[model samples]
Target chain A: MADFEIRDLRASVEGKEILKGVTLAINKGEVHAVMGPNGSGKSTLSHTLMGHPGYTVDGGEVIFKGQNVLTLEPDERARLGMFLALQYPVVVPGISMTNFLRTALNAKRGYDGKDKTKQVSPKEFRSLLKGELEVLHMDDSFLPRYINDGFSGGEKKRAEILQMAILKPEIAILDETDSGLDIDSIKFVADAVNRMRGPELGVLIITHYTRVLQFIKPDFVHVLVDGKFVLSGGPEVADRLEKTGYSEWAEADEPAVLKPEEVA
Target chain B: MATVPKVDVGTDYKEKYGFFVPEDYVFKAKRGLNPDIVNEISWMKKEPEWMTKMRLRSLEIFRKKPMPTWGADLSVIDFENIFYYLKASNKQSTSWEDLPPDIKKTYDRLGVPEAERKFLAGVSAQYESEVVYHSLQKELTAKGVIFTDTDSALRDHPDLFKEYFGTVIPPADNKFSALNTAVWSGGSFIYVPKGVRVEIPLQAYFRINAENMGQFERTLIICDEGSFVHYIEGCTAPIYTTDSLHSAVVEIIVKKDARCRYTTIQNWSTNVFNLVTKRAMAYADATMEWVDGNLGSQITMKYPSVYLMEPGAKGDVLSVAFAGKGQHQDAGGKMIHVAPNTTSTITSKSISKAGGRTSYRVHIKMYPDAKNSKSFVKCDALLLDDESRSDTYPYNDVDAENVTLGHEATVSKVSDEQLFYLMSRGITRSEAETMIVNGFIEPFTKELPLEYAVELNRLIQLEMEGSVG
Candidate 1:
């Protein structure tokens, strides 16, 4: 069975339909890349899957570990091992990153039936955070600073990946994590994600460009257009789209289930 | 749509801390305030003639002065119906076991005795209109440091007490001050001799257990040259349908090169009016800090002030106010720079929820001689729901051209995005809000002692429960 599955997912924002009849599935250890042009509902799908309050799920079935996720709160969905690395992480002034991450990690552990009332000890949390910071090549000073309050764009993205590393979600969705990063920073983030990938973890990278995929290769690449996946193939699909651009798929009137050769 | 989980927010702090045991008092004054009632109080205390005359003069002022038509609504306050004085115990004791069982039980339930044993250098517990219990560490007393109730201080250290009592906040300063002066009873009085530093904090706990009680406790602290002291005071009242009144006047004098920190955490019941007058004078090279947290009371109007009297003097006021259902917290700070090179900073944080209202009314004044002085005032108000309201009223009067004065005020609602972000991190909406609110007031709480800071956060979390959907 799939670790996470979205069947005929339809959603809207403020009465305007965004994710219309979207369907996808990801099992543990698999990496699925959904590439699309701007305003093609790339972020809508990620937000809808994570149950952002702004997006209304008009009709959908988001199943995580054989349970309907749409019926749960965002925090509930998060405890069920679903994580969304927001494209633009929000800044919470005076809330240290260490405090937030520890609270989140403890919440996840609590939901996993490991003594919900017990929190991670300070020494344990410190060592865990230090290890993850080293993995992401982040400075230790970032731990005490307010969560993303004055972080640079690259720093914010890297922090999101660090959170993923700490939480170790079963299904991780990265939404435009590579949008605002230098080449070196992109490689750092990609390397961190690649290191965390294993049979117990499923990855979904949503992006408008294929540059990030070069470092963190995906098992399947899907072309999303007009709120639906028009094509699906192996990693070659991303390479072909990189050469051909998304204009052809975006300009099509109807959803086209094209093969990798057809796109080429 | 996912239904928001319902968590029980009911914690009966009132039942635990508000239960009053019936005890026969030594004396109880009439419900009305007049010259006769004032004289009776002074005569009951057996105060000096000069103190009695001061009480008479303050009574005249209190009677002649009209209620100010600004800030909180005072029409609901019925001064005539308030009991001017109530003495729960005849004499103050220096030991917890010596105190009356009822009074001792009250403070024990409030955790006053535990706090004293754990951290405090001394403690003065006031019940109704007088201090029922008082104690201090022998080492502090041996170092020429005096920590006792104000009433006892007047008798024990009359010379020093007479020189500084009511000096910073005089009776004529305001109507409430005048009223407090006319009927003031029990409060903390501290004197740190020159070059002495009281490393541990001296604490005082005030409780009003009677209905329609008017508690007017006058506190006076004097930090001599090169001395240092930190004093903390906390208050709570039993729940009652009829309103009670707490009008206190606290005055402090920080001498040259001395430092003084005064902290107050007042958590009155909803049927209480808390109007207090607190002021400090910081002399040359001296520092005076006021760390205030106002959490309860139906209506509160307090703005602790400081006056920088000489060069190199500094004043800092950090305050936090949490106004829950049917409460109005009109609290802020005031700073006055009277000499050159003086500095002051005021930070106010307020939260309103469940149709409550909070307002920040702060004033900053720089005199002509206060050249090169700098003052920064920041006020932030957070409203938890649409029904809650907040307001900021800042008055900055800078007469000196060379002074740097900055004021910033922000009124914000807990943003949906911030809440959603925290909720997405596996925290419930209510828990996330509690965290944000705690962080918002971290600047003020961080200044508090560890125990007080932890208690403040717990109180705020209790107030924030069920506040978000």
Candidate 2:
């Protein structure tokens, strides 16, 4: 029961369904990748799992550990050990990355009131931040800069990884984390995720290309097409889809993916 | 990460500023207002012939004008009972050593001297009705930079003071402005010579150290062609049993090809009613920026305004308002584009927590002949608790068809998911709320000077305490 389970879940954004009945489970101690072509609900699935306000759950349930996540708010779910590395992480002006991380950390601690712990001292927090920066190869100035403001493509992804490292959420869903990164940046972020993957950590990496998976080496790969997972297999599936593209899935989901020719 | 349990002060935080008002100070006039007191204030200032006449005229206007029916309620304002002027010190001090000890203590408590020693190029400390300490670097003064108290400017550089004072905002501009014009006291006067740029910012710290006192500061800034200057003004008043009034009038003139930025942060005690009139004008190719923050006051009504009077000129105003219980922060900006190719942007962020009220009232107008003008106004509000109230009222008047105008506003409550996310990370509920609130006002805080921004965030955190169950 110490795992994330989605059972035949369906969701939609703005009244338009983007996630069909689907089932997937990721237990603690594994890295799973959901790869698909554009408009295949790959990103939507990730957002729905995180309970993005724009996405509404129409059916099924998402159980994080034993609690039904659908009953919880996004921040509540996050406090429940879920994190999302957004495809386009919001650029919040005026909020420094360091300050944002500190607030998030304190919020998580508030729930675990059982431990009578003192707030992290500024000195210790700064040093811990410095250590995280060193691991991510980020500059010291990045913390003072506004969160993701004026950040380049690679820097934004690196920032997301740094947040994941700091908060250390139990279940991390990285949505298109490798979309705009160069090969080197992709390698760095993938390595960061790999280093974070352990028996105590579970990850759901959402991406369109198989490039990032090459380094992260997911334990499982799933093909999401037309709002539904058409196939699920081991890491080899990413290679097959990368070579053939979405043509086969496009033909198979003609009814589910496309509308019938309208009367003119 | 560890969470610090919130300390329950049981309303003791409100009492922290209880002694902010000094009791021993003698009252020059009663709490209520009257024409006799206005005349007495004029008599005390020992003004020039024309200045006294202007004050009498302003007083007459104030008497005849009706209280504003819009915005915050003024029924609580007993004009006849409030003193027009109360001088804490008889003379202005050119150096810190000459200032009265208590006044100096006030500045020391507020860290004005430390701030000056660290970053400020010049400092003006106004306590009660006069400047107790004023000084500027000789290098800046030698560069033709003029910085002094407004009254001092009127006495020494009358020509410069007369040219810009009341030009941007006239005495009859509004009732509060008229009241301020009649009883105006200590405020900063700055002039950046043509083609001269001030490297470090000039700061003015205004404090109301006496009880039942009304502070009417008049500030004037003139930046000549090709010149640049950044001025910051901050105000703090001790909490008092009876309400105090702070009505200030600020006028700025940014000449052609020059730039000026005026920043104000006010943290008045919950009992003070702050009514202020601040405006600026920009000439051809000039720029004017107002970065204002209003965090504390029982009732605050301030709108930093800009008039883009020449083509190629620009105006930008960014403001943030936080209203806690029993407080009403009605603040925003006004942008008037009167020339072709002019542009203006106003971004306002407000937070209303614990049954407090915040309103964003903005106005953007482009003249009929002003072609190619553009104005964008965005107001965002975050409601932490259900009892709090927030409103956005923006007016966009575009007479010129060629102008592009846009206004967007959104009122959002703290996202539960965002809160839960922070909690799972080991942060407390209060800390989570603080993060969301900070993020909501990041646009405004980032625009403030570093130290000022830090203080603003800390104050917000303090106000958000006990907000979570």
Candidate 3:
């Protein structure tokens, strides 16, 4: 069985269908890239998979580690080794990043049936946070600031990657993580992800552009259009799409077929 | 990752601190207020004749002044049903063992003595109508610092007490001030000598442990030239079916080049009406700060004020109010700039939940001669539900030309995106809400002492539980 699977998932926002019978599966040690155009329901799928309250799962199931996660709350799904890196992170003023990260880490640990009676000591937490920050190339100053309150665009994205590094979920969903980031930042974030990659982690990189794929190569690339995956291939498919553009798949009514030569 | 204990957020908070001892008073005055009751209180205290006359004059003012019709509902406050004077103990002692057992137990439960021994430079514990226990560290006393109850200050340092008492805030300043002056009994009086700095804070605990009690405590502090002091006070009352009243008048004087900081955390049970008048006067190059937090009370109407009287004087007021079910917190600050080049800042934060209401009432006055002065006021209110309400009423009277004044107010409801962001990171919904609320008041809580800040955060978290379905 796949480590995580979304079977015929249908979701809606504000009574309008966004994810229409989307099926996807991810294994334990593979990176799956979901490339789509604007308004192609990429974020909706990410949000629905994580059980965001605003996104209603009208139909289908999100099975994570053999448990249906659609019925769970966002936080519950997160503890089940599912993580969604938000496209537009919200700013929580007055809460330091260190405090929030620690709380989140502890919550995940407790949910994993660890010894809930013992919290990570301050010294241990600080050292761990320091290591994560170094991996993400974030300054120690970010730890004391209110969570993303006045952070720059690149800083917010880096902070999200930093959180992902600290939490180390089994299946990570990076929703447009490369958006609004400069080339250097994209490289930095991709390097951090590459370092954390191993058999224990599966990555789902959602993006509108193929620019990020130049840094973080994917094992499989799926073309998502109108809430459905129309074509599936490998790294060469992204190179082809980069030249052909999403307009071909975006405007097509039926699912497009991937020519054999485009697959790698 | 300790198993988060199931905090009893639904339980009555007053129950923990509200367990009352049997009524054993050395003197108990009759319910209701009149000139005779005021004079009788003065007579019982054996106060100087002038003080007795002042009490009579204040009683007249209290009667003449009408109930405030603008703020929280005052119709529920039945003046005729309140016991204005009930002295639980006769003399104030320096030792906890010397205090009456019942009163001592009340303080022990409230952790007054423990706090004093831990960090406070001095402590004064007031029960009902009088200070039951008072103590000052010998080091502070030997430094010419006077920290005692107001009643004792009047008898021991009469000349100094008479010089500054009622000078910053007079009897007729407001109706509650007049009422407090007429019936005031136990409160702190601190005098810091010139150039002397009190390193640690002097704390006072006021606990009302009786039904139908009216606690009118008058506090005054004087920080002489180049001196510094910080005074903290905490108040709590027992749960009663009928309403209790807490009307206090606090006055402070910050002399030339001196600084004083006063902090108050009032959690007076849901059956109490807490109306207070607190003001301070800052002289040339002096600084005055008022950190006020109001967490409980059926209705609370308090607006701590500061008067920037001389050049280079500064005033800062950081206040936070949390109004839960059936509570109305009408609290804010006032800053008056009377001299040139003075500066003032007022930051107010409030939260209203469970059909409760919170209002920020601010007033900033810049006099004609107050040129080149600056004043900044910020008020932020958070509503937890649609039924909860928040309001901001600001009155800015600027008569000076070269002054720079700015006022900003915001009323916000918890945003769905913010909640989702926190929850997406594995924090529970209620925990996320509590974190957001704490972050909203971070500026105010950060200004508080470490222990108080932790307690304030805990109280806010307890209040946030079950706030969302």
Going through the candidates in order, the fraction of native interface contacts each one reproduces equals: 0.63, 0.45, 0.84
Model 3: per-residue Cα lDDT over A1-264, one tens digit each: 788988999989999998889888898799999988778899998888887778888899978877898888889888888888888999999999999999899887774324756567788888988888887888898989999989998999999999999888999999999887877888899999999889999999998778788899999999888888988889987887877877676373332223344322
Total backbone clashes of model 3? Answer: 1
Query: Tens digit of lDDT per residue, candidate 2, span B1-469?
Result: 1112222233443365232223343334456565556555654455565676677678788888998898998798877676566554421213445433433443344455453421111122223323432235466678989887777788889787877778888999999899889888778889999999998778764322321133788989999999999998874322222237889999999999999999888776567789999999999999999998888778999989889999999999998898888889999899998999999999888899889999989998888878999899989898878999999888878888788888889988887656644443445567667877887887777777788777666667656773211
Poorly placed runs, candidate 2 (over 4 Å)? A1-93, A101-161, A167-190, A197-264, B1-27, B89-140, B206-214, B235-243, B398-401, B466-469
Model 1 stretches with alpha carbons more than 4 Å out = A111-118, A250-264, B1-25, B90-136, B205-214, B235-243, B466-469
Residues B133-238, model 1: lDDT tens digits? 2234566778988877788888888888888887788889889999999899888788899999989777664322221133788889999999999988873322
Specify the poorest-scoring 10-residue window by lDDT in model 3 chain A.
A255-264
lDDT of each: 0.81, 0.76, 0.81
Candidate 3, residues B145-242, lDDT tens digits: the string is 98877887899998998898888888898888998888898788899999999998877643222211337888899999999999988733222222
lDDT of 2 by residue, A58-168 (tens): 999988878989887676787778888878776655567887787666555552323547455678778878877877778888888876789998899999888888778
CAPRI class assigned to model 3: medium
Better of 2 and 3 by lDDT: 3
TM-score of chain A of each: 0.92, 0.91, 0.92
- DockQ-based CAPRI category assigned to the predicted complex of candidate 1: medium
Give per-residue lDDT, candidate 1, residue B30: 65
Candidate 2's docking class is acceptable
Looking at candidate 3, what is the lDDT of residue A139?
86
